[model samples]
Target: MRRAAIVGTGAIAAAHAESLRALGDRVELVAVADVDGERAAAFAKEWGVPRAHPGLAELLRAERLDLVHVCTPPRHHVPIALDCLAADVHVLVEKPPALSLSEVDLLVEAERASAGRVATVFQHRFGPAAIRLRRMAAEGVLGRSLVAKCDTLWYRGDAYFEVPWRGTWDSEGGGPTMGHGIHQFDLLLSILGPWSEIRALAARQARAVQTEDVSMALVTFADGTVASVVNSLLSPRETSELRFDFERATVEVEHLYGYTDAHWAITPAPGHDDVAASWREKPSGVVSGHRWQLAAVLDALDSGEPPPVTLADTRITMEFIAALYASAFTGTVVKAGDIGPDDPFYKSMEGAGAPWADAR
Candidate 1:
């Protein structure tokens, strides 16, 4: 059994612990760590973990872990992940793996120098609905993907940002665009492949934070498909939705956080009723969450292959985020390869400084 430990005793870390427990004999949750000593010890006791440490250094020195889940906030992801990789321990980090693409590049270099692999937690891609959609697209059953829409409109009050890191450029990165909508948009990118260019706008309309509360973008894929992307934390009636308009049918998934088969639907385009029927006939029952992704990570480690949501795949998503921020802040169309080493957005999402910085 692979020995696993989770750093960060937050709610997400508990989810990782539960997922590790669910894996039974395949993996073991050996330790828990947090910046707060009491919190880490409490979490260890609560999860039945044998060890608890105040920090990653203590945990690493105590146990020879096979895997480490970097469940900390975005700013700390790269440092902790690098340390784990240097110790030859595979790492699974939560979403928004790093604050910037440059930081991701550093982690990539670290991984190259180590025997371990790094993966980000994008559990939405593991759902059966997502799997079925991917298969349909691959099999040409969905026909030519033309237009798409991804909306991640969820409500977050001003109190949510009182934590000091909830909506900052340096800590949590961008607001809804980086934290909330990334899941939906990442799945969208997974379906549509490489994005070509983006023209976008971001605003701090409601919440009191250092970042934009809402962002909208028009994205063009390399294959000539276009998409409208919306990420918001100001919506009263929250929902996460994605729609892909193919020549044969329109496939959609509607869910708030996670989704099952019942949350998905397909509408046939006139004579393409077979497409709808085939979608229903396909196997589905999995709910997208940490558990599903953890199982896949364990399987990949067992087979000596990179885990799901590898850093290379996540870099595409991160690059798209960089492009979105660049387009929004600069009032210019940003392309896939446009945000290279010299771009400010590559170093920070604020892109030198947000246009509205003085106004705020």
Candidate 2:
């Protein structure tokens, strides 16, 4: 069994710890680390972890871990991942893997030289229904994807941003686009493929924060499919939704956080009534979460291959976020590969600051 550890004792860390326990047959939860010593100790005790350290350095020196989950906040993802890379330990980092496209590129460069691989936690892509959707798309059962809509409308009040790191560009990245909506849209991108261009707008609608509480964009895929996107932190009756219109069927899913196959529905187009039966044939009851993804990660490692949500695919999602910010701030249509080394958005999602920075 591979030895593993977690580097943060936050709310999200519990999910990672539980996921590790669920995959106990293949890995051992050896240790845990957090800046808060007492909290780390408490977490270790609660989770039955053997060791607890005050920081990553201590945990690294104390245990010969094979895999490390970087469950810390966004700002610390890169540095900790870099440390893991230096130690040749594979990493399964949380979402918003790094704060910027440049930071992701840095990981890309470090990953090239390290013995271990870096995979982002995008568990939604591993759900049984999602796998079925990808297979159906590949088999042309859904036909050519024509248009889509992705919306992550969730509510967060001022108290939510009181955590100090919740809203800032440097700390949490670019608001809901980088945080809340990324999971839904990343799954969308996984199913639809590479996005070619985007034009977007952002605003600080309700939440009193440095970043936009609401963002909307029109994205065009390389395959000529078009999608309307929205990420918001100011909705009352909130939901996470995606709708894809293909030549043969319209596939849609609606859920709040995690989803099972039941949340998905497919409406067959004329002369394609068989699509409904095909959808029903897929497996069900698997909810999207860390457990599903952790299993895949271990399987990949066992096979001597890189894990799911590889850094290359991660770059696509990160670049898309950067492009959205670049377009929102500069009011320009940003094409794929436009945020190169020289671009401001490549260095940071703020990209010269949002238009309403001073006003907020």
Candidate 3:
């Protein structure tokens, strides 16, 4: 069995635990760790895990880990992942890999050096809606994609900021873009392809947090496909959706918990009844497939297949984030893929003092 250890025990960390337990006989939950000793012990007791480590180092020593899942906040991903890589353990980390694009580069380098795998949790990419939508797009049911959009209009109250790092530019990265909006947007880019350039406006409206709780962006892809993205944490009824409009059809992808079945409604464009008829004749589509994503990684471990999500894919997201920061900070559009090894963020933004304390 592929033995695994989880090194964080917070809310999302609990989700990791659930996914691991869901892995069942194919994987074993070897241990859990948290900086807070009591929390670690409590999690271990609750999950029936045989061991609990008060710190990450202790967990690594106790468990012969085949893979390690770094579920700590964004700030903790780099250190924990580096430790695992050095010990020759495969790693699966939560999204936005690190506080900044540069930090993720280090993990990428480690993955290369060890020739092992490290996956970012683009869990939304596994949601029911995402899987079906991707297949439809690939099969041209959407018929030459014309437009894509992502929205995360959600509400967060005063109690939401009760946590120390929620609103800050530091611990949690940008308020919604990195924290909440990254999910659907990642799915958008995954389906639509890398963007050519971005023009963005971010504001700290409707919340007493350091980062923008609401933001909007206009993106232009290399193929001239255009997209609009709006992300917020202050909406009354929160909804996350991504839609793709193609020359011949439009497909809407929707999901909840960022998991579960995502419905896809494919409608033919004004004069394309034939395309819709073909879909009706061949409607043997797939279901919302989060479990399938997990199965991919587990099967990779079993058969030595490379994980589907890779560092290059994550770099595209990071490059966009860096450009987003540049746009937000400079009040101008930023080109993707323009930042390179010589950029200020390349070597160490921390030492240079990043615009955001977290630099993401």
Error of 1 at 51 (Å): 0.9
Q: Write the per-residue lDDT of candidate 2 for residues 163-184, one digit (tens) a residue.
A: 9888999899989999999999
What value of lDDT does candidate 2 attain over all alpha carbons? 0.94
- Candidate 3 residue 69 Cα shift, in angstroms, is 1.3
lDDT of 1 by residue, 81-123 (tens): 9999989999999989999999999999999999989999999
lDDT for position 108 in model 1? 90
Off by over 4 Å in 1: none
TM-score of 2: 0.99
Count of clashes, each model: 0, 0, 4
Among all candidates shown, the one with the greatest lDDT: 2
What lDDT does the true structure give each of the candidates? 0.92, 0.94, 0.75
**What's the lDDT for residue 279 in model 1?**
93
Better of 1 and 3 by lDDT: 1
lDDT (Cα, tens digit) per residue for candidate 3, span 1-360: 789888898877777677778887888888989999898889889888888888888888878888887888777888888888888888888876777777878888887778458878787676555655667678877667788888888788989898887776568766778877887888889888879999977766667666777778999988789999988888888787777888988767555454443255667888898766655554433443334566677887788876756778888887777676666656677888766777654433222333343533
Error at 111, model 3, angstroms:
1.6
Query: What is the alpha-carbon lDDT of model 1 when measured against the actual structure?
Result: 0.92
TM-score for each predicted model, relative to the true structure: 0.98, 0.99, 0.90
Model 3, TM vs. native = 0.90
Q: Model 2 residue 313 lDDT?
A: 92
